[model samples]
Target: MSLRKIKRPQGDFWFDFEAFAEDEDGFWLRGPVGTPWRAPHATGSSEVPVVVLLAPGRPWAAWWVGDPADRRLEIDVCRPPERDGNGWQYVDLELDPVLHETEGRVEIEDWDEYDESVRNGWMTADDAKLARVVAEGCAQLLHQRSEPWLDRGWKMLPDS
Candidate 1:
C-alpha cells in the first residue's frame, strides 16, 4: 500500500509528510519528504506496508513487512515473478500488527486507532487486518527468534 495519512485519537498523527499538528515543543519536525521522525525508520525501496510499535520498557519494534529498507530505500516490493527475496519479500502481506510481550500478554497500541479509522472511512478493513497480521507474526517472532524477523538490528543496504 502506498503511504496514506495515519490518524490516532491522541498523540501525534501521521499526515504523509504534511504536518497534521504542531511538534511537541512547537519546533519543526517535518522535512522536505515528510516527518523526520519517520525518515530514519523508513526501510524500503518502494512503497510497502510497515508497522512500528514503541514499548515503554522494551525496545521499539519494527515489522518491515515484505522488504527491509536497510540503508537503501528498497520500498518497492513487486509481484512474485519480479521479486528476488533479497529482502523480506512477502508481497501479498499488508497491515503490520506490532506486538510485544507485556506482563504475559501481547499488546498493540494502534488497534483502536485503526478501528476508528476504519469506522470513519479513513482506512479500509483490509489494511487494518494487514496490520493485525504483523502484530501476530511479531509476537511469534519475538518469542521464538527462529526466523528472519529475529534479527533486531538493521544493516544499511549498500548504495542506499
Candidate 2:
C-alpha cells in the first residue's frame, strides 16, 4: 500500500509499503530497509524496516522502527486516513509524539510547525484543537505503553 502525508502549506510526502496485516481497528504496513520515500525537499530510502498502523478513523498513525537495540514508536497526529487511489492519505497536523523505548522518553515534536500552521491559518482551528488532543493522548499512551498498536507493531517488526 502507499501512504501519503499531506502537509498544508508544505510539500507532501509519500511512502510505498506492503500490506503486512490487518485487523478490526486498522491495517499494518511494512516497509523494508531501503524502501524509497519522497518528500518536498529531499528523497531517501529507509535505513531500517518500519511497521506502521493506519486506522480508518483514528487521529494518529503509529510507526514502529525495527531496530532492535534502538526500537522506537512515532505517532503522527493527523485527520484520520482516507482512501486515496490504491493507498491512503491524511493531512498531517504537525504535532507528533515520539517514543524512544531504549531511553524511555516521550517527546512531542514539531510544536513550532503546529503553531505556525495555526497562526498562519494553514490549518483550521478545529483541526488544530484535535491535533493537540490527539498528540497529548498519544504521548500518554507512549508513556504508559498501554496502546495495543505499540505492542502489535513490535510483534510485526522484522525479525521480532
Candidate 3:
C-alpha cells in the first residue's frame, strides 16, 4: 500500500487521511505553522465548529462552535497555573457539555516565565474514553497503509 500524504503548513506531518480531522467543520487555528503551538485543539459550540490553538500560557486563539450537534475534541495543550503580576493566572477552555464536552485547563506562573517548553509542570486532561477511541482509529489507519514513511524519505536498503 502507498502512504497517503497531506500538506500542512509545517512541512508534512504523517497522518492517515481517514483518521485526520478533514471535515470542513474541523480546522486548526493557532500560531504560525511549524510552531509548537500549531495544533488543532478545541472545537466550538456555535452553529459552526471552531478549532482553537492555544498558546503555552497565553490565550491566543478561539474557535467558535455554531452548532450544538457539532462534536468538538481538544487534544493535549494545557499549561500550569502561574503568576501573572499581582496574582496567579491559568488558561481555561470550556464548551457546552450538553452538545460538546471539551474542557481543558492550564496552570501558569508569572506571565513572563510562562512557556509551553516546560512540560513536567503542566498537565493536559482530555476525555480518556475519547482519546482511546481516536488512538484506536489512528492505529487502524496505520495498519491499512503500506509505506507509511515514504513521505519521510525512507528507502529500502540492500546488501550487508
Most lDDT-accurate candidate: 2
Model 2 clash count equals: 0
Question: What's the ranking of the predictions by lDDT, best on top?
Answer: 2, 1, 3
lDDT of 2 by residue, 1-160 (tens): 7899999888799998888788975988899898889999999998889988898888889898977777889899999998778888999999999998788999999999999999999999999999999999989989998756678787787653
Off by over 4 Å in 1: 1-106, 152-160
Stretches of candidate 2 above 4 Å error? 67-70
- Total backbone collisions for each predicted model: 20, 0, 17
Which candidate leads in TM-score?
2
List the lowest-lDDT window of 10 residues for candidate 2. 151-160
C-alpha local distance difference test of each model: 0.31, 0.89, 0.26
Worst 10 residues of 1 by lDDT: 72-81
Error of 2 at 108 (Å): 0.9
- Write model 3 residue lDDT over 1-160, tens digit each, in one string: 0111111222222211111222232222321122221124432222232333222343222222323444333222122223333322223221111213233222212222222212333323342233234334433433343433311111111111
Query: For candidate 3, what is the total of clashing residue pairs?
Result: 17
TM-score of each: 0.35, 0.93, 0.19
